[model samples]
Target: MLRIIGFLLFASFFSLKGQNVDFEYIDKVYVPTIKSVTFHPQGMGIAAPVSDVEGNIPLLLTFDELTNDVKRFSYKLIHCDFDWRPSELMEMEYINGYPEDNIQQYSFSSKTTLPYVHYELTLPNRGTRWTKSGNYLLIVYEDETEKFPVITKRFVVVNNLVQIEPRLVIPANASLYRTHQELDFVVNHPKLLIRQPAQEIKASVVQNGQWKNAVTGISPFSFRNQQIIFDYQGKIVFPGGKEFRPLDLRTLWQRTGQMADLIRTRTSTEVILFKDKLRGEEPYFQNRDINGRFFIETQDQNNQLAADYAQVVFNLYTVEPIYDKDVFLLGSFNDWSPSPEYRMIFSPEEKGYILKKPMKQGFYDYAFATRAKKEEKLDFMETEGSWYETENEYQIFIYYRPFGARYDEVIGYQVFNSKR
Candidate 1:
């Protein structure tokens, strides 16, 4: 009797364990995962495949209790801004293997453990037209009778092309070895061509070495035409008075060859901000109003310094004396950090904050920020590098059809222009 009773208890425990492990939750439903993501030859387009295996995008999901009731499953595509904020692009939805309206509905059975479903959608043809380019999240929600699970992933789109012709300039009486170089260009897109009138167009030069300063101007080329010409001047001056020779230009350009290609494909108007400030008597500041200035420079195609650095001077304001205050010049230049490399200091005689560190030639976005809890403030007063709100150009591209289809091979490409 004792042996039989012990055996029965052991069997009961085993059975309970099996049942508990098999239980499921609605949130645990398997999400159709996109495995390998790739782009065509020039990284001009994007592609991804969904599959279940190692070396693939993994979808680990669980579902609630099983039932034979669910007959089918479907999906919907939503477009969002660079920050994943919902935008006007959501009106467009394209799904594979289903009617447009029927795409959001799915048929499934509760008893089915693993059902096979494959769907693909292509974005409309607009080359580098996304107003902003950066990181974007794609959310895929499963359709079920009850609330379904959601899967999210990230992808990048870029538009860095410059439509207007760029010109090179060398300042007269400037030392070839010691003086900074500059490049200027204009955006000639017609007013009717832009989606937003408030958007500002920006021009930047690429160079081999670091740029010491940069500047840009925009105005109506003529009073009557309503047409505007943008002038971009960039300069690169070696720090500590060390002259940059022509040979150095060759090596630098070769190392940065991919820059042009990246600009062409991923250019967008997405603006990121960085800010910093310095007070009187601080290490890097000058006076109370005239703060330190900042700028960027880059290389051109001929292995010579292409343009002068774009310059940005920060304006400092008088504030109540506070001790141990900290300020930073934050932006894409210093990896968007408030570190010693990008710190700003005050100069009492000069009445401003100063940036003593020399920056390499390139386009940069930066702003001012303070550390004191009471003094901490976001400074929009002094603009550095390039302002984000300026009108910029973008290109969009749409690649359609499955990867293996012979006739469907990358069948579509288009370009759209957005201003603001």
Candidate 2:
């Protein structure tokens, strides 16, 4: 009787874990059970990807579950085009091995108040590999049917065959001089002959390694001497957001960088961060920043796989809440997309906004932002200041879809920094 009850409870949990996944976005976590999800090129930090196509480098996928017991999870890959849409190829055409595989790597957190399991998997494992170079979506599901996925994230598989020359500088327009930076680039395809370069070539530009505001479907302004040049003044301008605020939660024994206080109890530990204020009117102070990217690291544990979790409390200072706006704590730690989970609530008693969230032990960079009611745009300048001289990273991607081809192929990629 006890065995049957245990089996039923296991089945019930798996049923709840099966949630529909949408592939339209870049980083998405479907199930509420999952937390602290990260996917990137192994040892390359968060913004860089393994660019080699010969299987010399592999990608890493990691996540944690709130439950104490371990669970079975499987993952599959979906090939996408340069525009992040599904490609025109079949599963067998892109994947050299099986389409789906199990996640065999995981471990439980050690010497921590929060009891949970951390799972890590590598892409192009022994049973799975990619045959093409382009965009990809890693879909993680709880069952073999794969009817619903618990998490989905986008990754790049690059085969750098073409050279790209990129430049970052102040914008030519005087109006945007104090707030924006400009990007210029040239794509040189010496080995591959692209007929009708204007119609076949597509260019995309991303700021701070984020896809929310990436400029895509751009054509080159000039084509000369086997070089496609993109020097548009108005189209390539990006807002230079101020330096990101850092928070350190790598240890619990003593307060670390930017930590206001640390509270410990029998069940869990909470780290309260110092109150932050609006920087809209502040001058542009040059400080070291990662261009809005974060990496997971821990000093308490020997490795990140053994790191523990902590409940982090973030405080924002304000005399009173804005009448028609809502504030959010945004950063790469939350995929730079502010959902309701990261929304800040006004504390009338404290006269500030407070957001308490569970986070892994690591160094995180974040910013405060505001959005008006029923609005889709987030106003970073309302909280974190924007300046033209602020250092930022820009990445340029060149794609080609020939007249006979059915998929968009990445022909060139280049990264540059402004005032680095």
The lDDT per prediction is: 0.29, 0.80
Q: Global CA lDDT of candidate 2, please?
A: 0.80
Query: Model 2, 72-139: lDDT tens per residue?
Result: 89888877777887777767678888878889998987767877789999877889988887777788
Quote the RMSD, in angstroms, for model 1.
22.3
Candidate 1 Cα outliers beyond 4 Å, as residue runs: 1-85, 91-162, 165-185, 190-227, 231-322, 327-372, 375-420
Q: What TM-score would each prediction reach against the true structure?
A: 0.24, 0.92
Tens digit per residue, CA lDDT, model 1, 1-420: 999987986675455223323212111223323211111212222122111112122221112212234323332233333223333322212122221122222233211122212233232112111223322333344444653434333333333322344443453324442222333334444432333312332222212111112121122232113333433222311111111111011112233321222111121211111223332222221111101212222344332122211123333433432246666665423323355655666766645565544223343333455566455343322222222122222222211122232211111112221121
